[model samples]
Target: MLATMSTFELIDEASDLGQAVIKSNVYQHYLLAKKELQADPDAQERIRKFNQLKDQYDEVQRFGRYHPDYDKVSTDIRKIKREVDLTETVSVFKKAERDLEALLNEVSEIIARAVSESIKVPTGNPFFDNMSCSGGCSSGGGCGCS
Candidate 1:
């Protein structure tokens, strides 16, 4: 019963943390930017056009045929890609995605470091903590050589 209660408490705390993340300004902006990206028809069309051109090029490569218009298609694809990249909605959405990704990465790293620290195994010198010996040491055991 005690173990179960503790588990529930931990879950509740995690849920609260998740709620806090969702309420953060960064997360809110990410949601808004994602909505803007979804609602922009011009941005969607540009992305679709780029995909179609890419698929056509892939098909040509798959059939091993020398496509006369390959260069033209590639150029068009690049142009559409550039235009889509320059679109405000797309750019905002990408920035928001990167921001959210960075936040998540930081959270993950913090969690990982905390967990690792708690369960850390001693590796002799903390400063030169390499798991394996490089075997390049002039004196066998001095430089992490077992």
Candidate 2:
């Protein structure tokens, strides 16, 4: 027979899992990359400019194509976004961030599957989004357990 955990014990176990994740290589890499990105003044300036232009783009979006500055803002944001993305520190940080996110998603899926394969785990991946139905439910919409 399997032993059941009390609520406090479950909370403790969850905390332990969180600590383990923080100690993981993926998480460590993410932190180091983030730190490097923050320390890079050029990258920071590019990111700031990109965000400022993005805010302008959001405001212009309210008017759709009618806004006079809409096209300019859109073009500027795209250019700055490319610059930000091309920065070595930012690129490394983004990859590390994605890696960390994937690791967390995998852990969540494992825990959810351990309880029941039918339990829907919100994996950020679009490919596996529809694969949550393991019990042979034929519905294309999803497991439809909700």
Candidate 3:
């Protein structure tokens, strides 16, 4: 069975990548600050600062990837892929297909509203409204979110 993704699914996936990039960059800055802190003459104070930075970095890492809710959704999607007979459940599939379509429409509308309100959608350059993928890398692995 072939799985299809909607444009909004792509958008959400892209947004996930965008958030990951931000988190990774912050973590890198954190590591750098940590190293700088380590060399300070006040050893105990520096040690405390290092642990605090480390905890914040670790918390962001956990928030970005190791969440229980994400694990559950991943598991559910996998299970559905393996067990559901797409041909046998046309109505169910069709209903879900419509739901996804509706969801995508809603997402687009939200973005339009944000744009109209002069709110910047933080995902990256807005050029994806017309173009295609260009594989690139960031020193901080920001996924370029473009």
CA lDDT scores, all candidates in order: 0.74, 0.84, 0.47
Pairs that collide in candidate 1 are none
User: Residue 35 lDDT in model 1?
Assistant: 95
Q: Give the per-residue lDDT of model 3 (tens digit) for 49-99.
A: 555555555555577566645555555544444433332333343444444
- Model 3 scores worst on lDDT over the 10 consecutive residues at 128-137
Mark the regions of model 2 whose C-alpha exceeds 4 Å error after superposition: 1-5, 127-146
Ranked candidates, highest lDDT first: 2, 1, 3
- Model 1 off-target regions past 4 Å? 1-3, 63-65, 117-146
Kindly list the per-residue Cα lDDT of model 2 for residues 1-146, writing each as its tens digit. 56567877988999999999999999999999999999999999999998888889999999999999988988888899999999999999989988888889889988998898778666675554443434444466565633
For candidate 2, the clash count comes to 0
Better of 1 and 3 by TM-score: 1
RMSD of each: 9.4, 5.1, 23.7
lDDT string, candidate 1, 1-146, tens digits: 45788898989988987898799888999999999999999999998888888888786666453677767776777898899999999999988877776666556546656677443333333344334423443465765654
> Given candidate 3, what's the lDDT at residue 73?
52
